[model samples]
Target: MSYDSAKAAFADWGVDTETALSKLAEIPISMHCWQGDDVVGFEAKTGNSGGGIQATGNHPGRARTPDELRADLEFSYSMIPGKHRLNLHACYLDTDQNPDRDEIEYSHFAPWVDWATDQGLGLDFNPTFFAHEKADDNLTLSHPDQGIREFWIEHGKRSRDIAAQMGAALGSPVVNNIWVPDGYKDTPVDRMEPRQRLENSLDTMMATKHDKAQMLDAVESKLFGIGVEACTVGSHEFYMGYATRKGTLLCLDMGHFHPTENVADKLSSVALSVDEILLHVSRPMRWDSDHVILLDDAILQMAQELVSAGLLDRTHIGLDFFDATISRTAAWVIGTRNMQKALLRALLAPWDRLKSAENNLDYTSRLVVTEEIKDLPYATVWAEFCDRMGVPSGQSLISDLHQYQAGVSGRG
Candidate 1:
């Protein structure tokens, strides 16, 4: 069970444990900021988190201020191995000015950029299309009224600029993702008009483009949400065609598909058409419950697909779960670490051997080797990775999490 023994075992299968660890360290997962505050952003005029967006639980130590959230993020990142990026929403702007979503400027988020710069972290951005008056009807860009649609359009445009500024400041490209809750609770009489309106709105909003090095555009799709059960305007097909035509990244949220769907399978299919991909990795308990991810089959398959298809370079992995039922900081660390673990497992797989078996139609060898590798000291290798990355594993990790919870228990 020792790391040395595990390394030798993997070497016998034509896998290099050192190479796997090196590759895992290079991949950075973008952690969502909303998890710290239960998606109740620091906006002055925040509305109900409608549109199927709700974080359940009354866990103590929910971050209430920008500073507190940053502190919590700092602690979470400390426990997670390797460098990572922070995914920020426009509503999380840290500023004294009370700006509406459409009126938001880079100045409102300058503090976050400064903090990220100091911490040596990259930044990703999302335009807050929900939790606002305009989104009360579960529509924004696809709103029937031009005035309502324009309001959201302006917000989207402003978000791109802010993301570009952040990316420029950090000297890295920021992924500016757009996800709208435009859908109908009941079946719509006509879906065409709304989609057409959304298409036009997107065209107008993305007319002015920043350098790709500063910002990359991504459009996220959803199957359905709480009130929008009957219809989701930004379905996978809608955004897949849009992203393909517009040459923008397509965001495939794990929780945004049918319960039985395997999102990992879509990576290779979508990659053929789109230049880049953005993944909002999360766990869905029957629905888009946004549960903190565990090292389960779904995650393992996702990581395996990324590794097998050679999609790591073109894919951006980001965590998008907000669970307030536990220590918020711990939720971030656990989910992000699980994602890292999945990638590490995938990296250590004897991919070449498996592929050769499959290519030769050696079904028995393929099946046997795949199942046999499951018992191969993966935990031992993972522990070595944690140790090398200066993070705790096993009981030590649990103790650290509990200590953090006790420290923040007085948030009430």
Candidate 2:
């Protein structure tokens, strides 16, 4: 199973292994920082920190500070192949003085900009919307209290500014994403009130324009959360229409949809309307469990749609899972590596042949060829890609990962 052998075998079926690897290198997968710390940022805690989101498992070696999280991220990045970007939550600011969510400033994140500069990584951002006094009712931007809603609106605006600063410093466009928990636990009589408030807050926050080259704005919707079980203010329809009208990226988190629904099915419709999109790659069991990603059917289908629709450039792929059951560093490595593998698998497909079969009304041949290509020596090509990228290939990273768990991760 040499690289040359795999390349020649794929070539027989109108696929170019070399081209797939090259294209994969160009796509920057944004690795999330919260995975290294169980989503607990350095912000000084006021009250209970669990804000609808839950990270199950008490894995030791969880990072407790900004420096430790950055160190863990540095090591994890070394194991994963290809150059990538880093995704940050607003709560992860590296500053001595902790500022309230709405009061946060760009200077607080200057240290992160310096680190990204040295690592050659671009940065993306999110505004922390829950786990605060204002959101005790599980509402922030959509709260009926106009004062509370305005506070979150300011936080969202500041986050965009910080993200824009990161992009300006790193010479890349940073995507500032907003996801709030505004829902009712039990069935509420009134759902429109909260949604109306959410729409107004978004209009106010996005009213002031920022440089498009420096940053991009995105809105993420969720099906449900811990408290917001009955209804969610930012449902798919709300954000979809808002993104379409406002001209922003609509983030689609895999775990946000129902158990039976495939998130890939919504890609074509979103691509047709939104200017671009941001995808949060995660593994959800029965709900938004936030499990580490795998090379499963869901991931393959997503990659296929992205490539087949020619939406690779129009989509920003970011990892969004934090499983504390295993080594956190291993979680980062496994999830990111699997995402890259899925993208490579999709890229290596013989699209010309598949499309031609579909064009000729040869349904039987198309089905047969699609299934047959699954047995191709994809592992050989993946190993070659990792080798060429100057990283450990295959399960060889396990030995190094174990060493880090004992040495570095334990120190945290």
The TM-score values for the models, in the order shown, are 0.99, 0.98
lDDT of each: 0.93, 0.90
lDDT of 1: 0.93
The 10-residue segment of model 2 with minimum total lDDT is 44-53
lDDT per residue as tens, model 1, 34-91? 9999999998654656669999999999999999999999988989989999999999
True-structure lDDT of candidate 2: 0.90
Candidate with top TM-score is 1
Candidate 2 per-residue lDDT, tens place, 294-399, comes to 9999999999999998999999999999888899999999999999999999999989889999999999999999999999999999998889888896567888
lDDT for residue 302 in candidate 1, whole number 0-100: 99
**Residue 356 in candidate 1 has what lDDT?**
94
Candidate 1: residue 314 Cα off by (Å) = 0.3
How well does candidate 1 score on lDDT at residue 289? Answer: 92
- Model 1 clash pairs are none
Poorly placed runs, candidate 1 (over 4 Å)? none
